[model samples]
Target: MRKRERLELIKKLILEHKISTQQELLDILENAGQTLTQATISRDMNEIGIIKIPGPDGSYIYGLSKDKLRQEGHRIDETPSILAVSPLVDGLEKMIHVDVVPGTSRLIKRQLLTKYKEMIFSLIADDDSLLLVAKTDFYQQVIRQKLESMVVSDEQ
Candidate 1:
């Protein structure tokens, strides 16, 4: 299937069912006669700005951004904070993992690119999340704090 079609199916599945993981989504697609891999689904989710929201039972389920849902009057149950996803800090590797709301990653990346062009070694994005590799611990701290503040401000 084309990326657009695949993304539409994903959105439909999420709206119709509580899809919690990439594997579950893949299974659903396969049962519907579409063959796809977990990685493909992940990339598609990223492309379409899908993020995981906390489900009623505590597990996370795929959700559209508030910007998309507002017009439809579907309320998102939880408001995510920057720390809700838990940043994974790897001191040994000088890398930090940050989970952001979809669409926000691109904004964050653009801002970081302009501000930390020299200190950041690399920035990788996947769905509503990103990994930042810094040239030093100082850079990592700076980037992490700035990102956290940005996310919080956006949520407000």
Candidate 2:
């Protein structure tokens, strides 16, 4: 499998299983019929910022680092909310909370501004929440409209 696909599979397994060692990871991949070398695994681990955490079995298991410090200068403790939105000409910032899956936050953060360029400056995303800081009220308004439109009604 390609590196990108392999990495995604590794992440899926780690989230779904109790993996504590490279051997276990290797077994998982092998069972899935994709072989990987230890060196490749180690490199993938470092690239993805995987870390070990204490588990109930008195052993440390591999998992993604959820620490804010590991995040790219975005403080997770910062309770982000849509503070305000002003027109671009008026000079204001907009903020909003986006509820998304934890694993997809990084992917969303990478291209938010480019994908939605109307009024976003930056984004701070965690497991299930994203703080979008808009560069102008126009952007804020646009984002709010998009979000509201995306809201799904509970129905059969």
Give all candidates' CA lDDT scores.
0.71, 0.65
CA-RMSD of model 1: 6.1
TM-score for all models, in order of appearance = 0.55, 0.44
Q: What is the Cα-based TM-score of model 1?
A: 0.55
lDDT of 1 by residue, 64-143 (tens): 76556765687754454354334554444567777775445654565568899898999887657777788998887787
Error of 1 at 22 (Å): 1.7
Summing lDDT over every window of 10 consecutive residues in candidate 2, give the lowest-scoring window. 78-87
Question: Which window of ten consecutive residues has the lowest lDDT sum in model 1?
Answer: 77-86
Q: Pick the candidate with the highest lDDT.
A: 1
Q: How good is model 2 by TM-score?
A: 0.44
